[model samples]
Target: MEFRYLGNSGLKISEITFGNWLTHGSQVENDVAARCVRAALDAGISTFDTADVYANTAAETVLGEALKGERRQSLEIFTKVFGPTGPKGHNDVGLSRKHILESIDGSLTRLQTDYVDLYQAHRYDFQTPLEETMQAFADVVRQGKALYIGVSEWTAEQLRNGHALAKALGFQLISNQPQYSMLWRVIEAEVVPASEELGVSQIVWSPMAQGVLSGKYLPGRPAPEGSRATDEKGGANTIKRWLADEVLSGVQLLKPIADEAGLTMPQLAIAWVLQNKNVASAIMGASRPEQVAGNVAAAGVVLEPGIMNQIDAAIGSLAERDPAQTKSPASREA
Candidate 1:
């Protein structure tokens, strides 16, 4: 697998990071999930991404069990805070000092690791003072619970402010995890430039636009059964916006583009995101073991400028590029 440096840090992770967001502990059986992790490792993936909030913390336990015997030094493990993982108590969420301090220990325990390579705030906590959050992150670094810090779905201004505070506190904010894909370009306008200046790379999630770019969902028809669009657990809700006829019709135009590039629709989609120099890694999750290696093939593949232009034309006016769209919860109440 191809590797790239994460931000300005010397640490490098696999181009395609294995992530378990909606599948692990929720949509798949433990054995199936473990097989997918095995598939990722067999395919040369060394980076694994998860969150404490995923499946109410069961996902981490499953991942920990799946990766029990691997050499820890060889893997780049990441997890997130600022989500209600436990029983949704008053102190269960946000980036408050109490939550940040308490959550990392829980995350470490669940992941079966003493320290995560990078610990990210899942979302911006508008209610908490940014100083409190960054200070807590700095302390986590000093305590060796996490080697680096990052934030997800934060606005450009929020990243700048947080980066400044993290610097003042003596720990670097090296990455930002955002939902990015050929159809979702919100980060390109503002966050990318700000992160570029701040020396932060993007660990983009949903590079397939939650399977919308896979070209399996055709326009003017009902979603195929057993697909994410039909998943009642939560996947259906997250992918519903892209189920519109207009978006689906526009997505259909990419099939020929993928054929010309000698890539599956999903591979083309994943490769499209990695073309950005500021993107350190693109997170890909799979429900089946067989799907892992196919997506990983997109890692080192480079699309020519003409193919890139064709992609833009195919999805023209259907993409979401408004800089105002990259935001987190207005208030993540604990």
Candidate 2:
């Protein structure tokens, strides 16, 4: 696997990061999840990403157990906060200092690790002062709970404010996790520029659009049985926005393009995201071992300029490029 420096940070992560968002702890059996993680390792992937809120925090525990006995220093493990992972309470969510402090401890316990390579704010907490959030992150680094800090789905303004605070406080804010895919280009117009200027690389999630870009969900047909579209445990709901006929049909048109490049549709989609110099890694999730092997093959494959232009022409109009569309909850309401 190819390794790239995460922004300007000294750490290097695999080009394709194994992530467990919807598949681990909830969708797949423990044996299946463990096999997928093993597949990632066999394919030379050393970076794993998860969030405390995934499957109500079970994802972290599963990932931790999956990585047990591996040389910890060889892997770059990342997890997130800023979601409601606990019981209903006022301080149970957001990026408040209290939440950040408490959330890291719970995450460490669940992951069976003392320190995460990168700790991210899953979303901007508008209810809390940016200063409080940044300071709390600095404290996390100071306390050695997290080696670095990041944010996810944050707008250009939010990143700038947070980066400024991080700079003043003498800490590194090295990454942003956004939903980036062949059909989702919201990060292109604004977030990318802001992140590039601020020296923060993007570790993008949903690089396959929840498997839609893989050509498994056909246009003018029922979603394949047991596909993410039929997964009622949040996957179906998350993928509904991309289920429109136009989008699915547009995706279908890319099949020929994939053939021309001697690649699978999913590989083409992943390589497309990595073409952006601002992206440090493309986060991929899988339910099976073969899926992990197939996706990781896209790590070092570079698309020719003409192929890239063809991709843009094929799905350009169908893509979401509106900077305003990149949003976070004003306050994660309970």
- The numbered model that scores best in lDDT is 1
Quote each prediction's TM-score. Answer: 0.99, 0.98
Candidate 2: stretches off by over 4 Å: none
lDDT by residue (tens digit), candidate 1, 1-334: 9999999899999999999776899999999999999999999999999999999999999898999999999999999999896888988999999999999999899889999999999999989999999999999999999999999999999999999998899998999999999889999999999999999999999999999999999988889989999999999998998989899999999999999999999999999999999999999998999999999999999999999999899899999999999999798842
Candidate lDDT (C-alpha), each: 0.94, 0.92
- Candidate 2 has an lDDT of 0.92
Candidate 1: stretches off by over 4 Å: none
Worst lDDT window (10 residues) for model 1? Answer: 325-334
Candidate 1 similarity to native, TM-score: 0.99
